[model samples]
Target chain A: MNRSILLQSRPVGMPGPENFEFREGSVQEPQEGQAVIRTLYLSVDPYMRGRMSDAKSYVEPFKLNEVISGGIVGEVVESKSGDLQPGDKVIGMLGWRLYNTVDAGSVRKLDPSIAPLSAYLSVLGLTGLTAYFGLLDIGKPKAGETVVVSGAAGSVGMFVGQIAKIQGTRVVGIAGTDEKCEYLTRELGFDAAVNYKADNFQEELAAACPNGVDVYFDNVGGSVSDAVMNLLNDYARIPLCGAISSYNSTEDVGPRILSKLIKTRSMIKGFVLSDYASRQAEGMQQLGQWLAEGKLKYEETIVEGFDHVVDAFLQLFQGTNLGKMLVKVSDPQA
Target chain B: MNRSILLQSRPVGMPGPENFEFREGSVQEPQEGQAVIRTLYLSVDPYMRGRMSDAKSYVEPFKLNEVISGGIVGEVVESKSGDLQPGDKVIGMLGWRLYNTVDAGSVRKLDPSIAPLSAYLSVLGLTGLTAYFGLLDIGKPKAGETVVVSGAAGSVGMFVGQIAKIQGTRVVGIAGTDEKCEYLTRELGFDAAVNYKADNFQEELAAACPNGVDVYFDNVGGSVSDAVMNLLNDYARIPLCGAISSYNSTEDVGPRILSKLIKTRSMIKGFVLSDYASRQAEGMQQLGQWLAEGKLKYEETIVEGFDHVVDAFLQLFQGTNLGKMLVKVSDPQA
Candidate 1:
């Protein structure tokens, strides 16, 4: 029996567990050039919040009563294709189901010998690639420059700060709690990290970035972005990766920044991972090399069982997760 | 005697004639490397509003009780340098005085046969170059795309529309009055022009660009920009040239658009003409070639006498000028 989760209804503001529904069905038999895969791990990203709302966006809105689809890693249990064996592991954008019957060509086979299979769902996958392209291509951080990232404890934000450090830039991070702030600076080697909830957050941020911000990687927008914008140096570059803060808010209003932008001759660009689809391999290789060389490190917060998938996704908005949040459904039996 | 305009006081909000004072002084004798120039034409630009306030900007603020200087065209009346001769026309950033004794090297000699002396302050000068670089280099408008420009009847905006048209793109202009709208579409050859003051302005603008805006040349940043932002296409580019609407306002508040930018993977960059200083020659050559071919046109609103200089400048905030606003101090005797 395949247990699957579906979007029961569209969310109004902050999505609740009631918006999702669980169902059980028999797994389909594999045809020629097909494989039956047992789910191992799945990713819960903040960008998925955008897909829940019925609005025009980079991706289509999730249909009501349909299975929710996202990045998933699984083991091929039943295979009829010549290219794949029954014991091979693979990754693809798949439904939130215990078992998936898909075409063999749809999933990319993963080698567990290189890195952990779960890494493909976290630092080595979409999150890492998003950070790589957004920071290097758009932010273009230089040596001795200051790079500030909002949502510093989040999946993409963590990688942004780390990669910016690799480019010889002074990295400052903004997170919700003191623990997250400490982890960003102490564990991740960030130059500084400040709690946005503090009363003197604006002053602390200004003091941390004495030279002014040259590159700002924005993950959570709204007031956090408003504060960071005030410290932008001339010719500063901002890469708008995600806006988790405004994702749940109905009204998106803030201080108008065009005047400041004109005064400093700065630039801000919004981008998604799909914009660099052709360069995915290059990003993966560099991230893998860094991980192997001990130059880069990553952390993951894993929630056990498929039953807790909806809870894990809801926790993203609560700012509780320390790093990349993932659902570990079952261990790979390959 | 040289009659000069000085900044008597800083303005609180919108500047008035009270903020300026007239003074009389004896004209200085030309030194070995200097020349005496009689002011012919002086320019009044919206960007000058930023300099009027005692705030940090691209240019220094107007110091209290000191002579205010801007783009000026004049004729040499006394020359002690070999680089300049009496009866030669020149252009430079000079004081707003009837007579200016300046180093000859500071002013560039202008040939009257190439263009009218006043043209140096309008079409063939900073205004034209600003439009040329901001649209081509940053906006990157392509053939068959729709380009929308705000303040379309103003100096730089007029040139931006024409340049976009020359690139084979459909051009739309947004202005304050119906007469200005008609002038843009009928006289300036814009594809469409919408009066932003109309109650149905948003609807009219939507009707004008059926394909959606690919490039937005923003000059006025307020509710007008908020309206145009809603209709951006995927990968749209916005060149933040001016924010005339917010220049005098104490507080700048508006609807946030980062969500929309992420949705479209668009980019917005703020820039001044000084950023393109190295490429100024290239832009001037192109604009001059276009003007000689009868493919470009310019309009000037000249206020006679130095006494109306402050009035002409204040009129810019009222949106009364059709194009470049200049104060005609005197006719060149060269």
Candidate 2:
């Protein structure tokens, strides 16, 4: 039986367990040149929240009563195609189901020895690619310059700060909790980490970035972004990633400080992962090298079981997870 | 005697007559390597408003009880330097007064035969150079792309539209009045024009830009900018020149739809002319050629008396000026 999570309803302000429905169904037998895969892991991201609303966006909204689909890593249990075998580990844009009978070309095989299989959804994958292209292409951090990242402990933010650090920048991180702030400064070697939840978030941030912000990789928006924007130096570059702060808000968010952009002669650019599809290879090659050299490190907050997929996604908004948030669907056939 | 205007007080919200105090003073005789010039024309620009406030900005704030300075075209009245002679026309950063004893190297001689003396303060000068670099370097409008210029009938906007037209792109202009809109499409050769002050501004703009905006030259900010931002196409580029709309506002202007930048992969870059100072020669060369070819056109709202200089400067915020707003201080030698 294939257990799949369906978009039972559209969320109004914030999405919850009620917005999704779990369905049990039989898996289809693979046709010629087809493969059946058992889910191994599911990657939840902040961008997926954008896909839940029926608004004008880059990607289409998830239809009501239909299966929710996202980045998934799985193992092939049945294969008719000669290119893939029954025991190969694969990753693709697959359904959040126990089993999937996909076209052989829909999934690509991953070797476990090349970092962990989960890294395909993380450091060497979409999250890593987002950080690489956004920072290098837009942010363009220089050595000795101060680089600030909002949502510093999130999947994309963690990578953005590290990449800027690797470029020899003074990285100041902004996160929600004290532990996340500590992890960023103590473990990740960030120049400084300010807790956004702290009463003196703005003052702490200002003190941390005494030289003023040169490159700001924004993963969270609203007032937090506005506060960071106030400290931007002349010719600062802002790479707009995700406005996680206002995604699920029922009320109107306040105005962004746009005059700052003009006053400082700065630049703010917004882009998605798909925008750099052609340049993925260029990004992956560099990210892979950094991982092999032990120059980059990552942490994942894994929520066990397929039933908890919805909870894992909600955890993103709640700020319960640090680094990449994933649901371990199943263990591979060792 | 030199007539001067001093910033008597920093404006609380919108500046009025009281903020300026008129004064009369005597000029010193020219020293060696010095030249005294009679002010011919004074260029009043939107950016001047920024300098009036004591905020953290690229340029310094206007000091109390000192003559306000800006672009001035003049005739050399007394010269102790060989480079400048009496009756020679020149332009440079000069005081808002009848006479200025400036360093000989500070003022560059202008040939009236190439362009009218005031043209050095408008089309063939900083205004023209601003349009050239901002449109070509940052906006980068390609042929067949739809380029839109806000403040379309102003000095810089008129040149921006014309330059985009020369590039074979469809040009659309946005202004405050019907006359300005008509001038943009008729005299400036813009493909379409919309009056932002109209009751159905959004509808008018939507109709004018049917192809979606590919390049946006933003001079006016606030709600007007937000309306235009919504119509941006994929990979659109915005050259943010000025924010005249919100300069006088005491309260918060509405938020910029920054997510639009991300969804469409657009970029908004703010720049001051000094940032392109090194490339001024390149810009002027192109603008001069365009002017010589009769391909570029400009209009001037000339305030005849030095007493009305304050009125002319105030007209900028009121949207009364059609093109370059200049106060004619004196006439070039006839």
lDDT of 2 at A17: 94
**Candidate 2 chain A vs. true chain A: TM-score?**
0.98
Tell me the tens digit of each residue's lDDT in model 1 across B228-267: 9899999999999999999989998988888888888899
TM-score of each: 0.99, 0.97
User: Residue by residue across B72-127, what tens digits does model 2's lDDT show?
Assistant: 99998889999999999989998888899989999888988898899999988888
Give a tens-digit lDDT track for model 2, residues A133-248.
Answer: 99999999999999999999999999998999999999999999999999999988899999898888889999999999999999987778878988989999999998887788
Per-candidate clashes, comma-separated: 0, 0
The CAPRI classification for model 1 reads as: high
Best by DockQ: 1
Residue pair clashes in candidate 1: none
